[model samples]
Target: MSTQAKRATIYFDPDIHKALKIKSLETSRSITDLVNQAVKEALSDDVEDILSFEERKNEPLISYDQMVKKLRKDGRI
Candidate 1:
């Protein structure tokens, strides 16, 4: 991992880019900082999701149709 940040070019939809610019100005933060923080948060969420899936890897699988049938049989549907 590099301590220094590397520069990369990313494209955003026109409307989203406009919103980011407005948000950056309103927050008194650079667009770079906001974008980096958003990216970091998203990546963190992904890591958490992966860990949760790994932890639940051995759980049983059930189908939607089976669940509905069971519910109907139990008179709960």
Candidate 2:
């Protein structure tokens, strides 16, 4: 978290907005904090996925049809 924050305008569905309000009250946190945390977590997941792809960049690629045939041969599909 940073001491300074940026502001943005976001629109949510009515149900989602209501849910956020309820969660904020129950958790004693502001909607801004909750949304920021969620966004940070999503970005972290993306970073992880990118790192994983880079790590396995040299692995052989398998086509979908090939994969299905292999699975059937192995009695897995």
Give per-residue CA lDDT, model 2, range 4-77, as digits (tens): 88779999999999999999999999999999999989999999999999999999999999999999999998
Clashing pairs in 2: none
**Residue 58 miss distance in model 2 (angstroms):** 0.7
Best by lDDT: 2
Candidate 1 backbone collisions, by pair:
none
Q: Report model 1's TM-score to 2 decimal places.
A: 0.81
Q: How accurate is candidate 2 locally (lDDT)?
A: 0.96
- What is the C-alpha lDDT profile of model 1 across 1-77, one tens digit per residue? 35887889999999999999999999999899899899899999999999999999999998999899999999997
Q: Residue 58 lDDT in model 2?
A: 100
- In candidate 1, position 45 carries an lDDT of 100
Worst 10 residues of 1 by lDDT: 1-10
Whole-structure CA lDDT of model 1: 0.93
Looking at candidate 2, what is the lDDT of residue 72? 100
